[model samples]
Target: MGFWDWLTGRDTPPPAPVPEVDPAPTEGDILASLDGVDQLISGGALPAVVRSRAARVTRLVRQTLPRLGSLGLGSYDSYSVVATATDYLPEAIGAYLRLPRDWADSRPVENGKTPLLLLIDQLDLLGATMEKIYDAANSTDAAALITHGKFLQERFGHSPAADLNVPTPPSGNSPDPFDLERP
Candidate 1:
């Protein structure tokens, strides 16, 4: 509405909006922690089994992070992923790493289970827990897909033959005249 702008019939653009500070850790922040854990674990000289389980848990967390909102903010599942990235997973691995490898691997600290075995158990538990969270987080999308499919089916119509991939003869195709089974 300025005089020059009005005369020119051109409008001035509005100012850019400021981004609000989010309270929750963003994807980047979470990923950074996960990356840190990866570096820590990978840098240490650990057995393949340990590395595998840790990788599994980390992968689960990474996969689950995107759909985390589906699990709800401030929820236990969300917190678990965060904690695994930031604390639980790192701490367990770090504690094992701090101990002398040969001693830790050889000696039985708890009920005849070596530190390596205990670490594997912890990782397995974490991996399972992460899998549960990942499933829960992704269940929303699955539910949505099912709901959408149902809606489409209801709004249109179900095609059992098509759904089952069964084939039908083309229209206007002539049947074998010699066939006695022809209708």
Candidate 2:
């Protein structure tokens, strides 16, 4: 090392880089963690409502997961969404399950929701995400797809102007699609 560099303390080597790791857990890992959460809640002295909520979380997770797998979420892109469900689902339920009964129900957090409410909301959001993922994955189902299409057709397929089969008046102004043409 040069004398000036050593004296100035400018020759220090950079620290070794930390290894990169996947942020999200696998579906199997999440399921396993959820089993732990289930056991904890089931064995706890928590109130019946808390126990029921935890049970519901487990039920939805179990129901959504296999369908997710069947929907071919094998790649990283598709599976990334599944990661949040696995991670947060257990954390929310487990947090409520682990907290003391009084604290979970009575103690208020900053957002006006008690710890229990927060947990329930998180679980609900997770359930909705799972449902959305399931719907997207199952889009290949022709009957269901057709059913949805038919519903949209009945509700919004025909505009007022189109329903009357009237030709739109020629105008210089921007045409309002909602403005029905007078026959």
Candidate whose lDDT is highest: 1
Candidate 1 lDDT over 1-183, as tens digits, reads 789998887886777999998576768888898898889768858888999999999999989888878999899889989888888998999899989999999999999999999999999999999999999998898999999989988887975557787687677867867899777
Best by TM-score, which number? 1
Report lDDT (Cα) of residue 11, candidate 1.
Answer: 88
lDDT, candidate 2, 1-183, per-residue tens: 799998988878988999998765767776787787677677856556656766665665666665665466575425645555455665666666677878878988858889877876776665566556656656657667789878988999674556776785888876677888833
Model 1 TM-score is 0.74
Show pairs that collide, candidate 1.
none
RMSD of each: 13.4, 12.7
Question: lDDT for every model?
Answer: 0.89, 0.67
The Cα error of candidate 2 at residue 4, in Å, is: 28
Off by over 4 Å in 1: 1-24, 160-183
Quote each prediction's TM-score.
0.74, 0.52
